[model samples]
Target: MSNEQENPLLQYIFNNPEEFARNLTKIAENSGKALAAYLEPRESGRVQDETPEELSLAVKTLAQVGEYWMKDPARAIEAQTRLWTGYMHVWNNTLKRMAGEDSAPTITPAPGDKRFRDAEWEENQFFDFVKQMYLQTTQWAEHLVEGATDVDEHTRHKAAFYVRQITNAMAPSNFILTNPELLRETMTSNGENLVKGMEMLAEDIKAGNGEVKLRQSDPSSFEIGKNVANTPGKVIAQNDVCQLIQYEPQTEQVYKRPILVVPPWINKYYILDLNEEKSFIRWMVEQGHTVFVISWVNPDERQSQKSFEHYMQEGIFMALDTIQKTTQQSTVNAIGYCVGGTLLAIALAYMAKTGQKDRVATVTFLTTQVDFVHSGDLRVFVDEEQIKLLEDRMNKQGYLDGSKMATAFNMLRSNDLIWPYVINNYIRGKEPFPFDLLFWNSDATRLPAANHSFYLRNCYLTNNLAKGELEIDGIKIDLKDVEIPVYNLATREDHIAPAISVLEGSHCFGGPVEYVLAGSGHIAGVVNPPHKNKYQYWTNDGLHRDINDWLNTAEEHPGSWWPHWQEWITDKDNTLVKARKPGARRVKILEDAPGSYVKVRL
Candidate 1:
């Protein structure tokens, strides 16, 4: 064979040596400049001096895993043996492929694992071997963590989570050399991709003030009021904690009982109103239901002392009062998403204890958790040590930076959320397409110190709400007392609020509970509009203790939960009243919404 035929890379370089060298120089030049962006912050004292709190936690957690494994050398050695044997199989397979023989992969990516979805991962022998070996190593490490019986559950959970994050970061696809697509791009562009990537890295580091603010979507494409959260509403009431938005009526008549949607303060409410077609808020209004949503303020040091109770007082209570005055309705139907649902549950219990049970006639919880005993991996960060460290950090800023919470959430599904962005934005040198959901995701809100601290200690750490031990304003509130009708929705594939956790939490409600399971994660499952008819939900007349049992007997239905929810809520009282305008009676319109609160960027 000719020398050029022996190596395609050499042939390409031989054809365009000057271009190749220029690209290499560009890559080297930009690589050094990226560091300057990061270092500038340190020089100005903008970056903190101490070690990251998460790194410390990971080290401590991994130590426990090591301790457990070291106690049983035989088991540890066996795990190593399994890994080596797997590697040997991959080695033999790669050898066979090189010799022009067909060889099946030793291991493959798990179902729904998108990381290796690229065709090159399975089609190319070299990439296949690399993928299989990595999978085996990850599986072995996971099994080792699982076998660490001596390690406590909390330690084990942390170790497992930390390990996944590390493995994800170290994935073959993350690096240009191992990633076939990235490699092809680099060669074709003559290393220009790396230069562009480095420039982006520097800009991102500057954007995050020393941390990589991984851009998930083109932020320039969408504006809060212009495109997202544009469901035609007016902010009629305002408080320190939230802005009460009353959407304009789309139908001539609406249900007698208005729906007050209390979305989690952690995320902007636009997820439900990404656009007119997908907007749950728009659909609700179209279905002849008066809908009002709480737009939580992006808090700062001034709002640091805002406790959980204050959110209820200034958020839900204030909205409810506004709804009553506007429509002259005695009661309202309540909808709470995620943490907002938990707060609503607490508020309902408090109201019942204080003899104000008539204010909220019915309650619907979307991906909400009252009981946190099995709250999944989020509980790993709730222990005394981490919480104290977190509290101290929050104290310094008077509120936890929204980015920290955003990063923690992204960690839960790091492969889906984190690594993809890293590869696309940092390695491939590509800007992501405009995605509304991702834009809203990047728009994070600060958590007040007192509120966050109380929530962590009470709900996540102690499980007080489920135990009937949670107190509000010196009153011990019991969920058993707030026995109005309940519609509890849990998403099937939710990482933030697991279906099992939601099922377990249903036991806390004293009312006749109708538990429904929706397909997809926390956001998509709930925001699914009937128009799109994407995903499915399950309904069971009975609430079973085990989630599997509930699923086994449940009736599966196609389409969104919004229509199902509409049917359920309206079934209680379908009395038609003339649709009321924003700030109808007593209240005055503060401003047109997607309100100023929703527009506040951290």
Candidate 2:
């Protein structure tokens, strides 16, 4: 044996290679046996054994689809004729443009499409043909989905989604011949752009292990407590899971009840406190409300054993205790965002079950979901097979890498989030511009194996949380037990947490609920500031079981939802008291706002 001190596992394998190989073979044999047993019944030609009535129903459905298409033969013929005519016109226009005889084309790129923005795209015949072909293909796909009268709505929706993905993937801009900017760069740089791009590709491969780095900003440029998360405050408490940050009051008098923000640990907490101008934390403080945020640690292998219960205990529960003690308040308003909101909901249920209902004054959820039935496109990736694959990977690493999780999220919006950066950085050979939101997005945090696995299995796969089967520290939680008044906000275009899912989550609570639908996606909706005069929101006092009914009956307001939230939260008690400084006599200050934990990177 080698002199090196081998670990027990390695030592055994080294000493008994034959035995290890035999054992491995046996394990594979067992797995194959299990798989065969599972698949045997499924592959037994069950469909072939269907009764005559079932066969007839299947045939009838096919016939109905054919008849529906045939019924509109004349209209379809007309549409086909128009399409051919348009194609011919495009061809003729392209020839004329090439010959320098026409200023305008018969067909043009659609509005908001930056792909064909370069003059060469319209001026060059080959490029114009490519763009026209792509546009026509997408239009045809959309028309097919829209005109399918006999197909079920679900099938049509799924077909449209896949078709869109296909079209996006095959975009001409993704290639060199059709991309004018890329072609120009190649020529002007004498292939230096390609060399530079290769270097960038190599760097990204080394940094991300084959995953592309999409964000345009330099992370080092932005420092915590300097440029980002600069809101003046102090860390009142610290633990292995989280640090409680108490912001300095901007006003002399503040609300008696403080507000605690529970941001998701999946990302850094500085998202809410990006800078002085855009910081939601600063805005909350300036509004004369004492604000406290939980900055979760960027966990690694050392914290691999941490569970969701650990987060509940050392994160929200600990923060709440510190807030109550520091402010000398019996109850306080609490807010949770995304996954943090999910945690907060569970915490509230646990408290209610333990007869601590009076600990929280009001609960606010921002783009959060308690029910996962319609959790949007993300649900498609959560299943027995997928979870098992993920678990195997997590088991090896001790924690789920943030970059891997980020890649999955990026794929959800591949056209917007993934392809754009690929084209800009790899094809065009340009660096991404520094944007605060994108910078914050690139800063992701790892999830400990124990906590992540439990969350995925219990909440996602089995949906135990919604079913009231989710347990933390041996206590089962039921959202219905949460009797406090609730405020829920959902974004209209959020694919991560669908608006309907958020609305459905509100139904879980027994108490009165106020729900608002804000414009934009998950992060943008919550970070919306009133002064910018951007994005509208919808509000309805009544909570209806049907999401559409609520949307239809709701009143639309053209402004940020922050003012509305302020009105709702402050309406209960308008009384203001003298502002209390950070780190009261009870709890000593640990560090400044955006504290040490938030600064830790993977």
lDDT of each: 0.88, 0.79
Query: Distance (Å) between predicted and true CA of 500, model 1?
Result: 0.6
Model 1 lDDT tens row, 216-248 = 999999988888888898999998899999999
- In model 2, which regions exceed 4 Å deviation? 1-111, 135-167
Return the top candidate by lDDT: 1
For residue 391, what is the lDDT in candidate 1?
95
Candidate 1, residue 485: the lDDT equals 95
Among all candidates shown, the one with the greatest TM-score: 1
Give the per-residue Cα lDDT of candidate 1 at 425.
79
In candidate 2 the C-alpha lDDT for residue 6 amounts to 41
Task: Tell me each candidate's TM-score.
Answer: 0.96, 0.79
lDDT of 2 by residue, 1-602 (tens): 54324432231123444554554454455445444544444477421221354344334544544455567888668667766877887778777777778557665667777667877676456777888877876786577666776777544544555556668889898886667666665544445455545555555644553344555566667777898889999998998899999999899999999999999988988888888878888999999999999999999888899998899889988988888788888788999999999999999999999988888989999999899988887765566756786787778768998987786677688777778887777656677787888888888789999989898888778889999999888999999998888889999999999999999999999898899999999999889888988899999978987889999899999979999999999987778999989978668998777788887775
